[model samples]
Target: MGEAIHNVIIGNGSAGNGAAITLRERDPDCRITIITMGSLPFYNRYDLPRVFRGCYDWREILVHPLSYYDDHSITLRRNSRVTDVDARSRTITFAHNEVMHYDRLLVCAGGQGYLPEELSDYRGLMSGFGSFEAAMTTYKALPAGGTLVMLGGDMIGLDLARTLIDTGYRVVLLTNEYTFWPHRIAEDERDGFIQALGHMGIEVVDGVHPVAVEEGEAGKPARRVIFDDGGDVQGDVVMPSYGLVPTAEFMLGSGVDIERGLLVDPMLHTTDKNIWAAGDVCQIWSAEDNAYRFYYGWNNVRLMGEMAARNVTGANEAFEGLEDERLRIDKKGHIASPFWEH
Candidate 1:
């Protein structure tokens, strides 16, 4: 509204999409550019489990196709990653050495390397369970009758457990808690899950916090999991779906406030005011910079994106949180959307 079309969304995930739509809703004349590290067509990263199980194609897995963008008058730059963010210059550098200038920038960079590695570049081994390529790669590589030891009992891990069982792989899921999903799951639900898990041939042993994951068998005899509670579980391969650590490395040394993610007020404005972060990469815990927090699924991303879009377009908007939202598929092929507390 001042000089140029004033909004740029970095990352084409749900959060970025939400920001774009919200900005456009507030100001149609404002330009919206979505930069994605992955290939074209935005999909719900949560749908990767079904993809791994071969339940759906990549296109079917996507939330919205390219046509949606064209219909909405959105400009998308997919199949590329943004390498650097220049706040002072108000530009984003892409992997192809292209520079995108922006009046207002919203960073929705999302997930990063979560698994611990043996080498200093251990970040390389921490492949995300999301996306088309990752699902195809991981599922196709899973050997039938081979032991699949999974770390973490959160939504992703549970979904993966269901997927591996359906694909004929023996699963051994270990977690620190004595019971799976202790925070919200009730006794009846847990029993049903246990029954279903046993029916699916999954062996879930609890209170065994995985201290180290190595290649080979589990326990004292073979290369196995040594838990914090001093327990052991042997297996052939280990897949960790613990959680996502925000992929905000590009902001390093940028002097933009970062509390796990880009520090922003409820209005989504960063310390620089011109910059913002959406999705799991924003400091959403407090109105002031404090603890860092995040949530899974597309709804949060969509809403976050919308909020950022509005802010970039000069209308200040506050984000409450995606605190209770939950979208998960159980072993019986039923989709549940009950709001859950982490």
Candidate 2:
């Protein structure tokens, strides 16, 4: 028999894990290695906000335990960051200066939280509500009964705000948009959401932009958010809830096509036949639109990962993307939208 194919997956998020599991089930003899900068094993990122609110601990949110890797014969390398990729050579370099070769590579590095230009320099001062570690940091930094000035008003931000409020932290949410989920919710729904937030004792500010972040005194870190309107809000902990930006910096000059994200065909194959991409780090080619478009949400990402794995394993399956199902959380913290709506 020929040499066993070594599949290297650069991520440990939903997409990466999904791909790994699927690949293992499909090709038992293939070698698989999953790398991640995070120290923890694969966990439910959807429950990260709950982690911040004390609704779930780190162990509780983990999707699979450490033994899952051993049981499946999958190598899981945590705290290892991929620094560069050599597509021509089919090699990837890690932050520790180690290099590894792969017969097939999956770029599921996912996305990083997008901080505004003004707050970029002040990243150390604020907490992020994105990753599991970020949630833990936010939870630890939040003072009892103190104010939390949250930047951004996206769906994730709204959910985080509700969690904080329920956990007894006074929250001040800042958003440049006129309404939450402008592309998804109607104007009346937006107004109702704002009203609901007020009733929950959460402060919501719309149509405002943060121009700068000011450092705090006495080791309190950055506590002030300066607005474009010349107003400011002080908080014990400042958290940013901005959306994600594709984490494909390592693919630069690696022969992988990247525009906002790593470009992938309908089958999720990259320009390099040996390379594939999925999850938030990939932009799928939409045949109908004749352009690359982002497919957000957990279900879409998981499906993309599965498709990428299938294609990598010699299965010719085209990813048509998710249907009209939308997942929305109501004011009561329940999933109001049905699964079929997505």
Alpha-carbon lDDT of model 1: 0.67
Model 2 / residue 262 / CA error / Å: 0.4
Compare the candidates by TM-score and give the number of the best one. Answer: 2
List runs of model 1 lying over 4 Å from the truth: 1-6, 117-128, 166-168, 177-202, 209-214, 217-236, 285-292, 322-342
- What TM value does model 2 have? 0.89
Candidate 1 lDDT over 1-342, as tens digits, reads 266565778777878877777777777676778878788578766667776466657788777765888877888888777778788888878779988888888888886535544322323322347677876766655555667677665556666676777777778876533224313555455555555555656686755456655555344322366676777776655567555668888777666888677777777777886888888788775634465555455666667777777777667768876555534446664434442321
Listed per candidate, the RMSD to the true structure in angstroms reads: 5.1, 3.1
lDDT (C-alpha) at residue 116 in model 2: 65
Which 10 residues in a row give candidate 1 its minimum summed lDDT?
118-127
> How many clashes in candidate 2?
5
What digit string (tens of lDDT, one per residue) describes model 2 on residues 52-155?
Answer: 55654678888887689999999999999898999889999989999999999999999887776766888887877777878777787776777888787555
The lDDT of each candidate is 0.67, 0.80
Find the candidate with the highest lDDT and give its number.
2
Lowest lDDT sum, 10 consecutive residues, model 2, at 333-342
Estimate TM-scores for all models: 0.78, 0.89
